[model samples]
Target: MSNSPTPSLVKNGKEDFHHVEGLTSPNSHINVGDDYANNVNAKIRNPLLGISKPDLLAQVTAFCKEHDLEDKTSVFRKGSLLAQHPESFEDIEELDEEDKITIREEKTHKWRLPWALYYTVAICSLGSAIQGWDNTGANGANLSFPKEFGIENNTWLVGFVNAAPGISGLMSTWVADPMNNWVGRRGVIFITGLFVIFPVLGQAFTHNWWSLLICRLLMGFGMGIKTTTIPIMTSEIVPAAIRGGLVMSFQLFVAFGILVGFCSNLVFYRIGPLAWRFQLAAAFAPAVPIVILIWFCPESPRWLLKKHRYKDSFRSFCRLRNSEVIAARDLYYAHCQFVEEEEAFKGTTLAQRAKEIFTIPRIRRANLGGAIVMVAQQFSGINIMSFYSSTIFKEAGSNTLETLLASFGFGLVNFIFAFPAIWTIDTFGRRNLLLFTFPNMAWCLVAAGCCFLIPAENSARLPLIAFFVYLFTALYSPGIGPVPNVYASECFPLSHREIGVAFSIFINNTLSSILGLTFPSILSGMGPTGAFGFYAGLNMVAFVIIFFFLPETKQRTLEELDYIFGVPTRRHAAYQTRTWLPWFIKRYILFQSNARLEPLYHLEGLSGGTTVEVMAIH
Candidate 1:
C-alpha cells in the first residue's frame, strides 16, 4: 500500500530477497513496541532469512535497473561485486569476441571527442597565446623601442622594460588564489582579459618611458591571474583521458601566439617610429576573444561542487561531458572527493589551509614538485630565447634584418613543434617526455654555444647558431614546453590547486623577471657562447632532477594522484621510470579494446581497508 516498492513474496519458499542499500523499501516492514514483537514473531529472525545469495543478487539487479542506478560499484564495491558474482567472471572469460564486444559496449560509453569541449578548451587556451605574444612581442619591439624612448644605451632601462610585467606578475600572483576563490575561474579570466586589454592599449599609445613601464607592470597583474587559473580550469573541466593534451593545448597556443607576435613584428618592423607601439598593442588581439568566449562556456564543475551548488555543478558537468549518466557518475565521485577533502580540513580556516601547504608532507611534496617544474621551465632557457631572441641573434653577429628573421624562425619552430606534444603528452606521458626532451635541449644549447665560438665573419657562424636555436625549440616545445603546466596542475589537491599553481607561477615569473631583466647584461658580459653554455648546464641539471623526482601521471584521475603520492604505492622511485611506459601502453591498448580496465585499487578486497575506491574508466 505504501509508495515504496515492496520485496516480492516468495513462491513456495524458493524466491529470495536481499537487504540492498538504496533498493530496500523502508516502508515495507516497520513496527512500534508490541507491533515490532508481533512482526518479528510472524517473520523469520533474520530479514534475509531463507533467502539464497544468488536469488538476492538477482532481485537487487532488477531493482537497480528499475531505479536507473547503473553504477554497480556503488551497490557493490568492485572487489565485492566480483567476489559475489564469480559466475560473471567465468561468463566473461568464456565469451566469444563478438559477445565480449557486446558486453563491453553494454558496460562502457563510447568516447567521442566532442566539438564543444575542443572549442571551449581552445577558447580558454588563448590566455597562453596572449602570454606568448606579450612576452616575445617585446623582443622585436626592443630593437626600436629603446631608440624611441631615448634609453637605447641604458642597460637598466632595457632590463626594466623587459622585466616590468613579470615584476608586477610576481607581486600580483599572491592574489590569484584569493581572487579565484572569491570569483569563479571564468570570472578571474574575464578580469584578466580586462587587465590584458587596457594595459596593452596603453602601451600602444603611451609616449613617455614611465607610462610604457606602468602599462607593462599593469599587464603583469593580468598575466599572473591568467597563468595560474587557466591550466587549473582546463584540467578540472576535461576528463582525465585527454586532460594532458587539452592542458598542453594551452601551451600549444602559447607557441602560436609567439609565432603570431613574431609575424606581427615583421609586418610592423618597416613602419618606422610607430612599429614598436603597434607591436606593444598587438597583445590585445588574443585577449578580446578570450573575454568574449569565456562567457559562453561553463564555469568549472568542480568549483561549482565545492561551492555546494550541486544543481549548477550537474548542469556544468553535463555540458562538459555531454552525457547525463556520465555527468551524474562524475558528480557522485566529485561529491565524495569534496566531502573527504572537507573533513580533512574541517576546522581549518583559509589561512590554516594555506599553512598546511607546508605543514602537510604530501602537500609540501606536491608544492615542491610544482616548484621544480616551474623553476626548471624558466632555467631551461626557453624564455631567455623567447624574451631576448633578438639580443642573442644580434650578439651572434646578425644584422637587424637577420636578427628579426631569426626571432621569427625561433617562434615558428616553437609553434610547429608544440603540435607533437598534444599527442605525445597523453601517449608517451609527462615524466618520460621531460626525460627525453630536456637532454636534447641541453645538447642543442651546447651546440648553439659552440657555433657562437666560431669567428664572427664565418658564414657557418650565424647559420649554425640559428640551427641549434631552432633545434632547441624543436626539442623543448614537445617536451619541456607543455609538461610544466600539465605537471604543476596535477601535483596539488583540488582545494590547493589554485594556490599551488599560483605559487608556481609566482616562482616562474620571478625567475622570468630575473632572467629577462638580466639576460642582456649576461649576453653583454659573457657573450653569446658563454650565455648559452650557462643555459646548457642548467638544462642538463634539470634532466637529472626530473629523472629522480618526477613520477608518471598519465591515465590517472586528478584524485588518484593523492594516493599515488601518499604511500609511494605504484608510481614511485621503486619502479623504474622505463617500466611505466610499457605498462601504460598495455593499459591504453586494453582500454581501446573496450576491456573496461578498472584499477586494482578499486577492488577494496585487495587491501582490506577503508580506501578511496575510484574506478578509472577509459
Candidate 2:
C-alpha cells in the first residue's frame, strides 16, 4: 500500500488529503480553514501535521529541552516525524536503517515487547484472579456456609451474604476518581491489595453470617478500586494495535482464578464443613504477589503526563516500550492528544471530569456505550454460573461431589475458552464478537432450561444440563467476557478515563449485586427452567442494544476515538439499521460480491478536509 498523501479537492470548498484505503489507514489527514475548525463537526487536527521538516525538528528540540530530555533530541526528532506521518514512515528519508528496522518489527513482531511491559501487565492481571477466586470461593461456600450460619432456609439473607461484596463494590467505585487522582494507579492497587488479602482471609474464621458479610463487604472496597484502575493502567501502557488483546488479559486471568477457585473447592470438599473456609481463604493467595510486586513495575505514563510530570512520564514510557524511538514517538503523540483533550475538557477537578462524562456529547456517547456493555455482561447470565454454579448443579439433581465436579468443569471451560479472545478480540473486533455470540448464548440457555424437564430418573438429565450450561459459557468467554473491560477502558479520553471507567464498573457491580441478591429467589420462584428462559430473552435485548449503540473501536488510538464517538448516536444507529444491516444481508446472506458498506464516521486529518470511508469490517 502506498503511504504518500494524495490531494483531492472536494465540492464543499475544502482541501482533502487521502492516504491509503480501508480501516488500516483510517488516520488520514484533512486540511480545513479556521471557520471550519470552530464548527461542532470540526476535526481535531494533528499538531505535527503539515509542518516542514526543519520546523518539526525545531519543535522536537524545544520539547526535549522543556522536558529535560535534551540528551535524546536526535532520537525525538525522528520519532516525532514518524508520529506525525505514521503511515508514510518509509517515505521519510531522514529515518536511519535502525529506525526503519524497529518500525518494521513493530508490525511484524508486535508481541515482542519489553519484559517490563509484560511484567506490569502480568502483575496487574493478578488482580483479576483475586476477583475471580473471590467469586467462585463463594460459589462453593454457598453450599455449606448458609447452613453453618443457620441461614440456609432464609433465601434473602443467604443472598445478602453472597452479595455483600458487590454492594460495597458499588459504593467504592464512586471513590475511584478521587483516589486515582490523589494516589496514582500503583497506590490504589497496593491499598486495594491489602483489602483483598486480610478481609478474604477473615472469611475463613467468621463464626456468624454478619461477620462474614462484613469481611466480604470490606473486600469489595478493594475489589472496586483494583477493578476500576487495572484496565485503565493496562490500556495506557500498551500499543493501540494490540491493546484489546492485552487489556482483555484482565478477563483471561479472571478465568484462571475461577478455575483455581474450583480446584480449591474440590480439594477441600473432602474436609467436610471447613472446606468452605479454605475455599474462601484461598483467594488471598493471588493478592499477595500483586501487592508485593506492584512497586517494581513502572506507574502509568499517561497518569504521569496528566500530572505534568513530563520527565517521569518519559522515563516510565521507556521501561514499557522496546526502544527509545518507539517510546519517544508514543510520549510525544500522547502529549499532542492530551493538549487537545485539555482544551476540550478545560476542567482538572474530579467533579468537572465526572460531569463531562455525562454532559459532553462525545464523552456521553462513550459512557452510554461502555455502560451498555457492562450491563449486558451481567444480564448475559454468566455470573449466575460463576457465583452459583455449585448450587445450580445440585438443583439439577447432582450429589455434593457431583455438584463440585460439575462446577469445576464450568470453571475449566470458562478459563480455556477465554484463550481465543486473546487473538480474536483485536482481529475479529469487539462488536462483531458480541453480535455473533449473544444469539448462540440465548439458545444455549433455552436448551439448558429445557433439559431440566427431563425427569430426575433419567441418566442423561444431569449431563445434558451440564453440556448446555458449558456451551453458554464457551460462547461467553470469547465475546462478552473480555469485551466489556477492554471496550470501557479505551472508549474515553485520558481526562475522564478514571471517572468514566469507574462509572461503567459501578453499573457492572451494582447489577452484579442485584443478581446475586435476587437469583436464589428467582430460582425458587421461577424454577431453573423459567429463570434460564428469561435471561435468554435478555441476551437478545443486549444484542440489539449493542448493534445500535456500540461503535467498532478495534485498532483505533484512544485519541482517534473522539471522532468516532463524536458522531451522534442517532446517526450511528440509523446507519446500522438503514445501511449496514442491508449491506450485511446483501454481501453475506444474498451472496452479492459487489456489495459495499459505507463507513459511518469520516476521519478528518490536520491539514485539509478529506472524506475517507473507513469500512467497519472485521
Q: What's the lDDT for all of these models?
A: 0.71, 0.84
Model 1 lDDT-worst window of ten: 35-44
Task: List per-candidate RMSD values in Å.
Answer: 11.9, 5.9
Residue-wise lDDT of candidate 1 within 129-178, one digit each (tens)?
Answer: 88899877798888888998899888877988888989999968778778
Residue 409 lDDT, candidate 2, scale 0-100: 97
Task: Give the count of colliding residue pairs in each prediction.
Answer: 0, 7
Tell me the TM-score of each prediction against the true structure.
0.78, 0.92
Tell how far residue 588 is off in model 2, in angstroms: 2.4
Candidate 2 Cα misplacement greater than 4 A, ranges? 1-47, 344-347, 604-613
Model 2 score (lDDT) = 0.84
Q: lDDT (0-100) at residue 605 of candidate 2?
A: 42
lDDT for residue 393 in candidate 2, whole number 0-100: 89
